[model samples]
Every structure is written in C-alpha cells, then in structure tokens.
Target: MNTDNTLLNAVIGAVATIGLSFLGVSPVIGGAIAAYLEGGESGNGIRIGALSGLIASLPVAVILAAALVFLPLTGDIGVAIGGFVLVFVVVAIGVGFTVALSALGGLIGAYLKENA
Candidate 1:
C-alpha cells in the first residue's frame, strides 16, 4: 500500500468531515467522497473511511467527556456508574456509529466508482 496516498486520502477525508459537519450533512458523506477520490480498491475506501470517522469523532468525544463531568446526582446509587466509564462508553459508541456509517458510505462509493 502507498502510505503517502493513504495519508493523503485520510487528510482529505478529515477535511470533508469537518466541512460537511458545518453544512448539517453527515460527515460519512465526506469520507465516502474522499475514498472515492482516493481511487483504490474497496478495502482502501473502508480503511480511509474508518480513519476519517475516527478523526471526525474526536471533537464529539471531547464534548461528551466534558458534558459528562457535570452530572447531577439523583441519589440513586444503583445507577451511579463512574462518570469516566459512562463517558467512555458514550464516546466509544459514537465512534462506532461513525465508523460503521462511514465504512458503508465508502463501500458504496467505491463500488459505484469501480462499476462505472
């Protein structure tokens, strides 16, 4: 694999994620576009999409962690998991969601490009 091209694709994916995010569009679309432009095999798109999704979710992970820090206690000891654990779980899920969606998008785009 060409590391330089892969890195380039990842960078493009990141930029797409950031820009599409501000446009109220799903960042996965950006990942798909980047992977499509990268023009490698399907697996390449998947890898690039995953990278993009992970990077795109960085800000969300930070925001979720910050928000979880100020939890109001409900006096329910049973439901009181450590804030760190909760935050981690939420952020992990968010990352997982992004990765899955971005991967799907990448797969579709690559397929279309290849078949076209």
Candidate 2:
C-alpha cells in the first residue's frame, strides 16, 4: 500500500476506533465500517482495527503497566492468529473498560442521587 493510503487508513481507523469506544461499542466493528466505507478488503479492516486498537490502548497499557506490572502481559507467538487475537483483545478490552467505567460512574451518581 502507498504511504499516503496507509496513513489515511490509520487515521480513519484511529478516529473510528475512538469514537466507537466512547459510545461503548466495538472498535473492530467501527473499523469494519470504516473499511467498507473505504471500499471492501475485510483484511484491511482488520488491519485498521488493529492499528486503532494499538493507538487507543497505549495509554491504558502504559498506566496499567506502571501501576500493575504483573497485570500486563506481552508475548509474541503464532504470527497470524496471534496478531488477530491481540487486535480483538485490545479492542474488546478498551471498549469494555470504558463501558465499565461509565457504568460505575452512573451507579455512583445514582447512589449519591446527584441529579436530584
């Protein structure tokens, strides 16, 4: 792929990933939508999702790694399958984390009856 195309794809992927994650949705699904919008090649969609997930999860990974090193696991094995799994795992974790935090905030607000 051309450099420009790759950069554009990555940017598109990153934006979609962040937007979807904020909505408590899957980045991969958002990436797939981005890919379809960019035109077919589901594999490219996967790539975009992976790139997006990597970028989105970087801060979380760093914080978790520093605060809880034992919780952060990293390894390289089975190139194809492993890479795909890693991408999905990152996207899922990011989305789930955001969703869980949002739920917690809601519960706390409800408990405190902040709105009332």
Candidate 3:
C-alpha cells in the first residue's frame, strides 16, 4: 500500500521481465509476482500490474521500434513504412494484451492474499 513498496515492486517486476525473457517467458507472470508482493487491494493490484508491464516492456519496445529503421535498407521505403506500421499496431495490441493479462493475474493475487 505504501508508495515505497509500490515502487520496489515495480522495479522487481521490471527486472523479473528481463530475467524471464532469457527463457522466453511472459511478462504477466512477473507482473503477478510483483503485485502479490505489493499486497494491496484489487485496484492497487491492477494498477501495479499495469505499471509493471509498462516498465517491463519499455526498453524492448524502444529497441524494436528502432529496428524498424533497418527495414528501409532491403526494399521500397513505402512498403517498409507500411509494414512497420502494421507491425507496430500488432505490437501495441500485444502490449495491451500483456498488460490486461497481468492485471488479471494481479487481481487474482490480491484476492488470494486478502483471503489468506
């Protein structure tokens, strides 16, 4: 519930994401862990999950977006741009889905902690 705990959990969640990525893992699991550790209300859990996901994915998103720059080297610039836009859309949706799933997990964790 405290701001300090929230920040700590968010940092842990971000680090967990990076570690899990090496094993081709999902961010939702890490988000849940962070939220569970946070141990607040369901709303707080959801907020922590969303925050965690955002933090966790930020660097990867930036790198992937930057990689779009190389698309122009192989073919038509117009097509490349269009393809990049489409891929960007997909990535955005994927990010949203990841955040949503993390929120769900966080809610579950919150409930479990409350019931326990």
Over the stretch 21-95, how does candidate 3's per-residue lDDT look in tens digits? 765445767677777888879998888877777777777678778768887875897889887997698679867
> Against the hidden true structure, what lDDT does model 2 obtain?
0.47
The 0-to-1 C-alpha lDDT of every candidate, in the order given, reads 0.72, 0.47, 0.75
> After superposition, which runs of candidate 1 have C-alpha atoms over 4 Å from their true positions?
1-4, 22-25, 66-81
lDDT of 1 by residue, 1-116 (tens): 22447667766776777777766446568678767876678997787778777777888888897765565464555445566578779899988987777786677656766876
lDDT of 2 by residue, 1-116 (tens): 22336446545555655666656554554444334434434444445445545555555665543533332343433554565566557756865664344333323322332223
Supply the global lDDT for candidate 1: 0.72
TM-score of 3: 0.78
| Candidate with better TM-score, 2 vs 3 | 3
What TM-score does candidate 1 get on C-alpha atoms?
0.73
Q: Which is the leading candidate under lDDT?
A: 3
Predictions ranked by TM-score, top down? 3, 1, 2
The reply for model 2, stretches above 4 Å from the true place, is 1-4, 37-40, 68-116
lDDT of 1 at 48: 76
Clashes within 3 Å, all models in order: 0, 0, 0
Question: Between prediction 1 and prediction 3, which has the larger TM-score?
Answer: 3
lDDT of 2 at 98: 43
Candidate 3: RMSD to truth: 2.7
